[model samples]
Target chain A: MWAFDTIFVMEGMKMGEFKFISTLASVKASEVILDALFVIAIGVIVVFIALILLTAIFWLFGKFMQQGQKTSVFEEKGVNNDTSSEPHILPEIPVAEAGISEEVVAVISAAVAAMSADGKRYTVRRVRRVVNRPVWAAAGIAESTRPF
Target chain B: MNSLLQAIVDIWNESGFVRLFTLGTGNNLWERIASGGIGNLIMLGIACILLYLAIKKQFEPLLLLPIAFGMLLVNLPLGEVMKSQFNTLVPLTEQEYANYLKGIFDQSYPVFEMNGQYYWQHFETGGLLWYLYQGVKFGIYPPLIFLGIGAMTDFGPLIANPKSFLLGAAAQLGIFATFFGAAALGLTGISDLTFSSQEAASIAIIGGADGPTAIWLTSKLAPHLLGPIAVAAYSYMALVPIIQPPIMRALTTKKERSVVMQQLRPVSKTEKIMFPIFVTLIVVLLLPSAAPLVGMLMLGNLFRESGVVERISKTAQNELMNIITIFIGVTVGATANAATFLQPKTILIIILGLIAFSVGTAGGVLFGKLMYFFTGGKVNPLIGSAGVSAVPMAARVSQKVGQQENPANFLLMHAMGPNVAGVIGSAVAAGVLLTLFQ
Candidate 1:
């Protein structure tokens, strides 16, 4: 942020008092060129260092996350292999009579049958409305007063 | 009855209306205009032109409109709307200079010595706009604007491809280039067009192409030039569509422009949350001078990403940003009082600012080309021009130019990487300069 406190001190001096005052003030083409080149070199180096540091840090983080995921996957596989020794039991899930149109259900059932390769008869279960937030609300726009 | 009538007439004679008509008084309408002279008329015309550009042309109307009105309001005769205070511009008299030097070493003396003698004539209490200008004059508004920008900005693209940071840094070429250019102008023998190092540095930052950063730096380095610098920065930003395309085309071949970049990996929510914090830590530690801008920006981003402060994030993005923007625009405009803005140096600043922006664009594209060559055509050079820190605008220009080469080439997301990086880079540049000067 720009602060006003420094305004008084800076204004009291001319040209903000450059460290290489004499060379810049004289406006000698060669000297000015040298100073500018020096500044560019230093500025570029500084920016590159800061940005490159960030890049390296993020790269390392990505690697660490990947490694952690790999370890978790291995642990999950180990648990499943050990559990395979026992008989697996499937729990029955309760079904509800959902209010779906007969014709729509028939169409959906037929499509699912057509795509099935093993030819297992399936029953059309239920239909429900998907209650989801609108895009504006999800994006934190309180109401639907958005122009677009 | 006659005595009462005489008393009434005496009261009328002493009123403001009577004072306005009195030819020789300071409040006289004619004398007020006369005091401002031809410079005031030119500045008024300039303000009108700015208004036309803002209202009709729609060039950054959110900012330009307020700025133009401020310019118009401050330049009018007898407005008493602005006063020349000791900003970075006004040259100190010999006595004032001595006192100023003494004040630096002598803690007992006030920072400003002979303040009355060095200052321009105006009302003792200052004018209405001057009061409003405190936000800008004291350097309070820009950081708040940065907070809003932070809440609004998404760093996902920059985080997805950290390499864009180099492009962002490269885009600051114009700033340093323009600094040299402004100093070079001093040797041209036009006394009115010459720039002090401070003025040149402030003017050079116009190339950074970020409005708040430009205004912030100007307020610190050359507060007097804030009006022109802000106008030039915002105007060029608005003109990005016009200014950037040709430069992008000229810099890259058709094949280079048509090159399709690899899809960026999906950024996880955890990464998004950590990005702002990591950046704030890295940047502030590297350059503490950037703490206010970079820190506030990161804080705002944290607010948005944390998902815990939805209300504050929304306010920061919308209400707070809008309010500060209005104050910044109008108050900054008011600083362009006729006497200061009508000089030849103002013209030089405008010209140099454009040059700075152009050079910055070129620098980014050139760096992109270098990266492309190294990466074996993996990076599209077109996205490099987005490094000038105009945010979505520069990125859009890159996409537009790339599409012209290949109709199916959608470079927006890829371009955004450098685009957002440009913002960080420019702020860093400002921090660097501030550190150097301050």
Candidate 2:
């Protein structure tokens, strides 16, 4: 049998004798230390490399995010929709009258007027008030915690 | 009247209480305690200490309580809760090994046959704890536990700042360092206590600070050491408050600790949904061994983020997670029978596990300093210590220490970036080890 000075191979391996090794025998002291060092060196490198790959992928994904922002801008400008030739026509949204105080409406109108002073046209068509707690909040769940 | 009195006295002499306490058959309390051995007593004492920590101190009580109770149960005399059905530990003769295999695998339902002769057996069905432990032995509970963790994790912080992945990768220093420490102990000349390569691998994983990963890796690499490794991993996790702060303070300068980070840009919902799928593909393709853990974790995250399966996601996080945690705790606890637990190797594992965690924390903080210098002090080095993979606990410690330095600084969100990254990092480290060893 092939052997080293401190090696004491347990009974499991055999020539043409398929036996599984149940317990791993200890190696020489030097060998153990060296093997451990080798594992640490290689393992650390592997971890960094794997993470680096992930970072690169995410960076690439950031480029796609910029593109998505541009796409949303186009949609806002009616460039990617059926109303591209008719910005004044205004896409209609169905609405129902909602409970709101005149003071609240006046405040919203003032806020919109302040923004429109820079020649940006804007409109406020409807307002609504929430009277009851959401179902999740009533059931003792928080919105921030729901996803987790 | 005399005949009736005599019959009653005979029945009293044969009662279970008399059998239990009588000295004649060696079933008395004194004899039972003596036969239980010094190891059994020691383990029982350890179990009691663990229980006090778990119940009174609330030290990861969900897992520690079950494990300590399991330890207490198995160490008691005459409790067959952890006894094996067969003498599998002793060396079996060639014929005996064949017979043992035949008994378990053949069509004979708890019996073995040889040359038209039959013998009754219970190889597949042992103690109740043994039956429950199959979930651990076959590597079932850890992945299921990961599913729950997945459902519970919010990857938004990690997705918001993907560079936190590097800090997560850095904290795995504990696993590799402890591996070296365990092997180095072989030179100490304690033959019975020396760790083999496999044992060292298992012990080293205690530093990963991820309980499920530690258990899963132990079940495969060093099946016998699963109890101590799992216990060490979870105990250190609960002790995060005690262990991580000192290391974090030591590694970073006052200026580095006080560096306030800029707010991370908001991540889109599409990015959150794509994060898990892309991670699953990249990790599994690169390291197939990580599939079991990383795959399940991603699947759970997908269930949560997909929004279509809220019920299933909630069930995974609550009911399924709770059930598996109980099984994993009790079964892993039962593995620490007095005979196996009260050994020199177990003590070494405990000590080395602490060192591993400490070193891991330092590694992450030091790496954070490097990132701080590179980024022109934009990143706080204190949050780097959260890279040790103890989840929100490590992250919270970062926040606590940061707030102490600068009352206005809030590092919770910033620390969470690396905190969640550490989870993926440890899982990846585990994959690397499993791939290497397997």
Candidate 3:
């Protein structure tokens, strides 16, 4: 609301008192040129970010048509061996299910293993780390969890 | 009666104004015309028309009503009606006033010793409008208005569909087109009333249907032309309903306007929270010149978004906006005092203003149709026309027109996407112009 008072105070003193302060006032042109460069840079960034947003939008629309494919994939899984029968195995889900790359999955898996290195069969910290996993993947994992 | 006449003669011996008007102020009609007695009456007639447009037509009544009245007030000879007194708290002196107008000169004034110490004083003019005009002049009011605008605006829709940014950019086409129009008029050698690339560009921005940006930019680059530019900008903004629908109807077929857009998804609270911060950070970092306006707007949005600073957010929306609007209006009105405003270029500015607004609407709507073609009838082309930032007015026009084509179409929510986007578009166009000019 009140940004002008600084200009007033700076004006009240001559050079010596405001020696350090006057640099900003002196570099007005530089400030303006810097402003333009900054805007261009930001525009480039916003454009890329907007593309990311649009991808998310398109991804949302894709979810509707993929429902049938999702059910069939689960059906196919029922005929195959249950990966979870091997207690040490963590089943691999498609990238679409988790919205992450395989590399991101490995990094997450390593982090969880380190977090549970005390050798507890299952750890609460490990569970919380996996909670934000996509709903489809979470459902797939939940289908056969044995109640304690 | 004879004694009363004699008393009047005695009182008028000091000043002949009353007696002169009583005896008919001038012999010839032309002489009275030269005296501005007729000019004031003409100005009154103009003010009356403006009042009608504001009240009966409801074209930006909040500003137009006061501005029209202010016009009538200031036009009267030394009107006691609008004394334009300073706030009771601020004190100023003539020496202070003179010293301030000497600003550029003051920079080089002198380093002088007073009792073995040196001091320098900055120049600042305390002229009534010049002082307040400082805010208008250096691009201050736009952002302050933007702050109010930000608080009042709910970015939920834009956040819901972030891709609406395309519509906003599309609407800015009018700014570029008006530049050519202004240049063409300038080339015709019209009445020493030529627009510089800067001035013409600034004046043409009134078509964007954004008032504060138009005023802020015009005051900076073309301070002389601000009166007409501001009035035209606000007037057309108010006229969004009246002006835009014809082009919309003429351009679209019944099938086109009636195209029903799907219902907008409900945006999450978290999405709304991230939007202002994200958009502001991106826009301001890119366009720091736009930062003043974009920054303040984001600040106000942050207040609303964080869901914590409700009071400040409310104040920014209501009290702050109202106060600055009043100041923006009155000072703008004061600048229209006869000497500055009574000119041929003023009329030219008004004519160009209409052109700018019409062209802007055309551009936005036409682009919407193009998008509709690409989207295979999913997008209602009528909403495209409402991309002028007259806010709900333009949005409502889209809805009404679409309803005429198909009563059940219900494009209001969709039209709002572009309506709000137009605000950003005009602001960005204004930024581009400011960047060029500065």
**For residues B1-438, could you state the per-residue lDDT of candidate 3 as single tens digits?**
999999988877644233223211345664444345455566667778988988998878888887787676666654434343343222224564456557533455343445644444434434454456567766777789888888888776666555565665556666666665665553344534656656776777887788887887787777877777888888888777788899888877778887878767766566667667766666665455566766777777777778777778888999999988877876676566554565666777888888878887887788788888998888787777666787878889989988887776777878887787677666666666666554
Best by TM-score: 2
Q: How many collisions between residues are there in candidate 3? A: 4
lDDT of 2 by residue, B236-351 (tens): 99999999988888888888889888877777778879988998999888777888888899999999898888989999999999999999999899988755675567778899
Residue-level lDDT tens digits of model 3 in A56-104: 5533543443565678888888856565466565576444344556676
Worst 10-residue lDDT window, candidate 2 chain B:
B17-26
Lowest summed lDDT across 10 adjacent residues in model 1 chain B is found at B17-26
Candidate 1 has what TM-score?
Answer: 0.77
CAPRI tier of model 2:
acceptable
Model 2, which residues run further than 4 Å from truth?
Answer: A1-30, A74-127, A130-148, B1-35, B85-124
For all candidates in order, the CA lDDT equals: 0.79, 0.79, 0.66
Ranking by TM-score: 2, 1, 3
Tell me the DockQ of each model, to 2 decimals.
Answer: 0.22, 0.27, 0.03
Ranking under lDDT, best-scoring first? 1, 2, 3
lDDT for each residue of candidate 1 in B160-245, tens digit (9 for 90 to 100)? 78888888888999999898777666556566666766777788899999999999889998998998899999999999999999
C-alpha displacement of B92 in model 1, angstroms? 33
Which pairs clash inside model 2? none
